[model samples]
Target: MADRDFLLWPFLETRHRDWAEEVEAWAAANAARLSEGDTDEAVRNLTRAMGEAGLLRMAVPESGRLDVRSLCIARETLARHSGLADFAFAMAGLGTGSVTLFGDPALREAWLPAARAGTSLAAFALSEPEAGSDVAALSTTATRESDGHWRIDGSKTWISNGGIAATYAVFARTGEAPGARGLTAFLVPAGTPGLTIAERIEVSAPHPLATLRFEGVRVPDAHRLGAPGEGFKVAMATLDVFRATVGAAALGFARHALDLTVARASGRQLFGGPLFDQQMTQAAIAESAVDVETSALLVYRAAWLKDSGAPRVSREASMAKLHATEAAQRVADRCVQIHGGHGVVRDHPAEKLYREVRALRVYEGASEVQRIIIARAERARAEEAARCKPTP
Candidate 1:
């Protein structure tokens, strides 16, 4: 949407650049669907279009490896254009992340290929009404019967792609033990016998979020993603791969907002001079830019860490996600202030960007959760270093 370069110092190859350009062109042309009033049609059409364009194939790895950097880059670029565009691309990767990470060949073959082809819409159903950040509190349970069939009975709220998703990766309590250890991941189809859409959730920005009701929904044991008590582990692995993209999406929104701010502040006049002439306005703009650049560095660094064979990127990911999302919120707020009255107008692009960016701070992992995670990791790393160092 803006002339500013998006890729910060080229974290990718020529293919990535070519793909980003092509997708941007396509996104620019199809941008109308983003403002469409119907949420369901928008998601379905956008996802199918991404699939047909071959962008959706990037969601699944050829073998079992995920390129976190590529996913984050795609989300950043798409989020810069439209939130729906980002959703289309992100759902393709995230919805099937567990399958690629832990599912068996046959399961992967059945779902991953179909997902890549856009024939099947996948979603992750893990959060319950009470299990926002503390996933260990999930009440959804899957019990194995003598018939060897798994019966899942649980309620999942705040689920993305809820009503329209063709399939969902559901994490349920296996009744195996206690706490996070007893959870198991299941591949639940949309049309499963007892599965129902309890309600369609409406948030600030319209998306196909919904509450899922699973009552004795039976699937073969073959659909189990990882071993019992491994659902949290599987979900963590998925989050680790995609969480940076959450920040990227925020960065994209912030970039859009910044462009809008610069355009307005440079031209819009107050007190006989341009808005940019005001000291407060200039300071805000400068602060916003720093946030953007700093956020990009964190996002790419975390992405690089993962791609560089780092065992775990908890601290890096938390820093990236926290900084990027919080920064985007500030950036969007600054853009609104720069635009003055026009920013709040329904027709203004910043107005939409404002709504789109707010969700990133809360989803994936909330800012508070990120802070907690970062503090916990920092403490652990410090303690380990303390223990390993030779005393003087």
Candidate 2:
């Protein structure tokens, strides 16, 4: 099992610790079942199960204020037992994040409760075929109709929970201004006449993903999230809250990798002695442990900052995501090396973790993107400091 001592860190509270323990128990008990079926069926079942257990309540907070630390705790704990479980839980929060943060009462009333209860699924549709990191380049358009409704036309790719989601928060250009200023978010229910799941994407680590096509899909003005020309703000704000939790999920994968490594090294024999007796093996273990601890520190620091009411934890969150994901990849790699032939075999713990940890670095603002964000933030801070300095 992963280390439990991190729960005692000052970054958490009594309630967070309790939450971690509860999720840990639930995940441990359901670990086997989570990996049992096709990806789509497994995710649907997992969401329902987590909902019934009231675990999804954390994803959709009652007070409409997300407790970032609790989110980190839940993702980290759930991820340790099953990557699929973590994916299901994370999507529940992310898919509904725009609505939870900026939806009108009617939108929230329609989506949040059912999402929180796991009775329905939600998705955030932002990236298009041409727009991934370049949010300003999105080509999907939403035109205002004379009947006080919006007619949306475009396509979204790489959307999590794409085909299965009951509702989607779709971002489209409304031509209110230009570039990012013209974008707007809308709440579109599934089975809309012109909306279709164009393709189901398969990945190294399987999860529910699809390319969604929208052709003249229409919704009332009430379906809009936030205000006109505010979709960029809404999407960024939602991502800002979730970026740190991505690091927390990576930390979970790293911790699990470490646990598997330790167990393998301690029991496996090599050169007439336990593998743990080898100096090189011990060194690898030591380094992997350090990676795990450091990742936890960064993840929790970002989470704590957000929970403490920091207006924006962009720099901290980027640091956490960048470091933890990159570090987790290293840790998982070392784990596979330490396991020798057993590591690469299909369905092995090491093989699964290797695939699982890789995608973290690429998604949710990739490692390269995180570095760019950090650099820009630092530059801005330096510029502000220079502006405030005395004339001396």
Candidate 3:
């Protein structure tokens, strides 16, 4: 089993600790079935099961106040058990985050409950073919009609939970300003008059992902997530809230990889003795252990800061995501190495983890993007410190 010592850390409260154990128990009990069937079926089943277990409720809290620590705990625990399970839970929270944070009462009432129950799936439709990393480059347009409705046109790609989601929080250009300032967010339901699934994307690690097209799709004014031209704000705010949890997910994957590595090394025979007898094997395990612990520190630090009400956790969140994802990749590589031939065989846990841990580095802000955010934040902080130098 993965280590439970982190639950006792000061970063978590009693309730969070208890919640972590609860999720852990649930995940352990359901591990055998989480990856069953094809990707689409697995995700659907996982969502319903998680909802029935009351775990998905944490993703869409009733209090309208997101507890980042709780989110991180859930992601870490779920991810440790199954990557697809983590994906299912994270997308549900992220897809509706804009509505949860900024939607009017009617919109929230219409969406949050169903999402919390997992009876309906949700998608965050932000990226476009040309706007993957750069939000400002988004080309999707949502033109307002004279009758207080909006006509959405264009497409979104790389959308998680795309084809199967019951609703999507789609970002588009409303021409309120220019670049990122002119964006707007909308809640478009599946089976809308003009929304179509353009393509299904197959990835190394299977999950429900698709490219979507919207041609003259009309949504009522009530479905607008925030005020017009505030789409950028809504999208960024949602990502800021969810980014640290990405790191927590990476932490889970890394921890599980380390566990597998240790187990493999302790049992396998090498050079007429246990593989753990080799200094090289021991060294790899030691490095992975360090990576796992350090990743936990960064991930929870960001989560704790957010839960404690830091106005924006961009810097901390980016740092956590960058370090933990990169660290997890390294740890997974070592895990495969320690497992030797068994690691590369199809369906092996180490091989599956190698594939699963890879995408975390790319999504939720790539490591390169996280570095840029961190550097810019640091530069701004330094400039502010210098400006306040007591007039000396």
Measured over all alpha carbons after superposition, the RMSD of each candidate to the real structure, in angstroms, is 1.5, 0.9, 0.9
- Which of 1 and 3 is ahead in lDDT? 3
Per-residue CA lDDT of candidate 1, range 278-372, in tens? 99998998999999999988998899899889988988999999999999999999998888788899857888888988899899889999999
Q: Per-residue lDDT of 1-392 in model 2, one digit per residue for the tens?
A: 67889889998899998898889889999855866789888988899899989999989876788888889999998888899999999999999989999998877887799899988998989998899988999999999999999999999999999999999999999988889999999999998889999999999999899999999999999999999999999999999999999999999999999999999999999999999999999999999999989999999999999989999999999999999999999999999999999999998999999999999998888899999999999999999999999997
Give the Å error, residue 207, model 1: 0.8
In model 3, the worst 10-residue window by lDDT is 31-40
Q: Write the per-residue lDDT of candidate 3 for residues 15-97, one digit (tens) a residue.
A: 99889889989999995587688888888888888888899877888878788899999899889999999999998899888
**TM-score for each candidate, following the candidate numbering:** 0.96, 0.99, 0.99
Q: Report the lDDT of model 2 for residue 189.
A: 96
Model 2: CA > 4 A from native: none
Q: How many clashes would you count in candidate 3? A: 0
Steric collisions counted per model: 0, 0, 0
